[model samples]
Target: MLDKLAKAGDIIAADAVTRAIAKLSETPVPAGVHVEATEGGVLLSGRHLRRRMLGDPQLRNFGK
Candidate 1:
């Protein structure tokens, strides 16, 4: 029972992470900024620093 619960918890966590990543990938990047998702992970590029700072309050300095 405990093992099953543990497995279920892991699945839920993984799903949440995947959903969050998809949400982030769908966000529109600022003009000149580009975003792409590959097996390696998300790739972000461009001069528009503001858009890159989305979802991370700690990185707000980049937005400024």
Candidate 2:
């Protein structure tokens, strides 16, 4: 996926996913989860991706 994205001129998404995977030493990725790069951040195509990126949505403030 990163390869395809990189070839399509998406360095930002590719880099973000690469970094995210690298930091998965202790985290466990759930099944059937797809990842893609978005303008705001890396988009995890699954529910678990939420916890993987943001610890808890309710705990964070989106309206900075």
Candidate 3:
């Protein structure tokens, strides 16, 4: 029973990550930024972009 539950949880997590990657792929990114899909989640890379993005109130609330 515990094994079955663990498997189900893993499946759900994988599906969510897959869907998130798909959605992230559809979103537009700046010229220097790069988006890549990984086994755990998506990766975004750019020069000083993380700090700049989180500084903005609007973009910071994007997930919500």
Candidate 4:
């Protein structure tokens, strides 16, 4: 019936949202950076030295 269809749709939507969130959390970030889930959303925090030689592009090159 229509009600059953609506319930199924809601479940699908919720599952899709969860999957999207998981994918987002899996994203790669700078070294030493950390990610934690919060009530509102994911929180990213970390520290890195800002030396002229140490740049974003160079960082990505590392470990590869």
Highest-scoring model, lDDT: 3
Residue pairs clashing in model 4 are none
Question: Which tens-of-lDDT digit does each residue in 4-56 have in candidate 2?
Answer: 86677777767766676544422434455554544445445666655654664
Query: Considering TM-score, where higher is better, how would the candidates rank from best to worst?
Result: 1, 3, 4, 2
Q: Model 4, 1-64: lDDT tens per residue?
A: 6999999999998887676666656667666766565444566666753452256764444323
- Candidate number with greatest TM-score: 1
- Number of the candidate with higher TM-score, 2 or 4: 4
Evaluate model 4: give its TM-score: 0.55
Each prediction's TM-score versus the true structure: 0.62, 0.27, 0.57, 0.55
Deviation in angstroms for 35 in model 4?
Answer: 1.7
The TM-score measured for candidate 1 stands at 0.62
Please tell me which model should have the higher TM-score, number 2 or number 3.
3
Candidate 1 lDDT tens digits, 1-64: 6999999999998887677666666666556667676544566776655555765453343322
- lDDT tens readout by residue for model 3, 1-64: 6999999999998888789877875566666767776676667777887785777564354334
Name the Cα RMSD for model 4: 6.3
lDDT, model 1, position 43: 66
Model 1 residue runs over 4 Å out of place are: 38-41, 47-64
Give the Å error, residue 41, model 3. 0.6
